[model samples]
Target: MRTADSAAEFQTAAQWQSWLSQGSTFPVFQPVLSLETQTVFGYECFGRLDLSENVASLGTFFRASDQTLNTLQQEVGFTLAQQVAQFFSPVKDARLIVNELPSHLTALTPLELPSTLEALQQAKFPLNRVVLDVLLEPGFQNPLRLKTVMERCHSLGCQVALGNLGSENSQLDLIPYLKPDFIKISLTLFHRSFRDRQFRRTLEQLGRLAENSGSALLIEGIETAEELQQALQLGARYVQGYYFSAPGRLPAPLPDFQKKLREALENFRMIRTKRIQRQVTWENEMLLRLVDISFVLFEADGLLRLNETDLEGLSGFIHRLYFSDLNGFQISGDYLLSETGCQIDYRDVGRNLSLRPYFFDHVYKLHGRPGGWSLSDVYCDENSRCLMRTFSRYVTPQAILYLDVLWANFADL
Candidate 1:
């Protein structure tokens, strides 16, 4: 509640030292959500205090005297971290990301803080689960020292996650090498521009990297459905914000609701995929025959021109694309006629058809290839219809194709 100018009273050397020695005033837990399971994953640690004497605002107080406050903040962070470690006891697997300025890691010599390390060890919590979330606000002065500190943290079993990832400059490059377990994007930047086009792209790129590097993306400061939706769409594996839940609740009996929900969702997903696979397998031979027939009737040059018989056969082939065991089917007579070498009287499957891509994406790309004959990861298509694809290659066009497979029997759902 105090500003930088009013923080002078609390900025004295003795008072500051006393506050640091006294440790954190209070701590708050902000929830983070899991993308795959849509459940509460973990909480980010934040300070909650009404410091009347020293600092007006937490941010300003923390930043006013950088040289001294940096070390104090680290101490504060470690104390709160230990508290969190104590809170999630027995099965302390959930991540606790504690914010610490880069200056803290560099300024406070680890050699001098034997008590801090000892306290953490005595806490009986594995260091790896306690993520020291380093914010890239003021940035780091020495990359080598930061890397060394990060390595030391890792050596001690603690993990590091780069927070406030907005710029794609030097800091972004350092993440791949550091190979942190998680990445946190600031909601301020993510929500700016209504929908951050560049940020979304960056999220996608980072998400891919995280996937390969075994890291997770946590979108922070999410307060609205629109932001949450956008973050999820961009492949953020985890989210931290007010939309899912806010910070304040004390550690209570968190029911195993998330576990049960995940199990149910996973079960349904498996069932859906299994059903699609059965149908795809059933149509395999028939669909293969259809492809062969289309190739034979059209020939190499036959694709350039179409006869009445060819059109009829193409129509039948397209029809077999659905009924023959494959999933997706588009009923576009006009577009199909113009695109393919043959003519067809079937109705337009529509240009924006969701199943249309799967129809081609799966079938042609998968023929005889390992795992290609099977249906895709059973996900709902754009049309709100359940669809999967079989990828295979055709000898005629010498290109891969997907057989859009659809399963409309949602009576079970």
Candidate 2:
């Protein structure tokens, strides 16, 4: 588990350049998967080479390379690009995403690309199939030069990508202005409140921009199946990283593994759906009970009073309705003191109440609306906990006659 810093300790710029000149780098290809097809669409280029006591260490070598490393980086990138072009031949419609250091543009001109294109063409490679991913490390400062390079590559029919994009870095959004053919979102953003609805909305806005400008979205560093599912659900057209396939010189023979992953994802979906369905069934069942209880309470003479002990006894029933043993519930209305209750705080009923956020919301808003018996779908509380419940009230068009409760306190019933 050595990091970029740990890798840096073993190599220096001069040694890195020497390795590049000697063609000592080993190339690995990581598969990119299509969101819709769930199949391998292409491969992203990665480099690994043996360094001082470190076997096949990309992190260390790249970390150690400094300004002196620029010469070697350009040379290595061009040579690897050439190798990738050759490798992709005979795999019709398959693409290769070669990593490019921004500094390499100094050595590469519009004219030299023709020879690279010619080599690929000779190998029966499609010119449009090559995508050059411009890696945006902290040292990549020359945006104007990067723009020029991107324009030159695009004019030649090759696509350019904004690799490792970030919101904190002002330079990252420059891709939209330059109009790269694709934008590869950095993995860091995945952990940055991506599960939040606001973040998803922001992502949707970005996706819309990319769509309008004809730029494709490629999400990277999808290490887990859950992450891949979220990215695909969020409209990422392309995805890549260890979750799909690790980098290698050749495509990994993983048809069975791919099928297993697919089935696992499908199972995840089925489990979620069934869990929701179960909650709905419980809510419906509780609603029927609430309706029955409301009828009994409505026919009572006065306040129809019930106490904390009554609430406690109904805690089991509440547990069934809310599916949470931690909750307690109470219902209070004028001329209706029947508490099918637990020790739940009345002040907290609809606000600080432990029920799902949407459930609380529905109850608080239900006051003005006509209410017989109704249930809410599962939703995250403000604390991001899921809850389900049903509430029913016996009332006339002019006044509420009785209130009945079914919540987490009775969810398990």
Report per-prediction Cα RMSD to one decimal: 10.0, 9.2
Kindly list the per-residue Cα lDDT of model 2 for residues 198-292, writing each as its tens digit. Answer: 56645666777777778888888887777776675556788776765667676554465467446646865776687678867866776665554
lDDT (tens digit, per residue) of candidate 1 on 171-288: 7766776677788876566766355445555667777877777788887877765665566656677766665555653543345445633554565557668867876675675467
TM-score of 1: 0.54
Candidate 2 ranges with C-alpha deviation above 4 Å: 1-7, 10-12, 17-23, 51-54, 59-65, 106-125, 139-141, 167-172, 194-205, 257-413
Residue 303 miss distance in model 2 (angstroms): 41
After superposition, the stretches of candidate 1 with alpha carbons farther than 4 Å from their true spots are: 1-24, 51-59, 63-65, 78-93, 108-118, 167-170, 193-196, 253-413
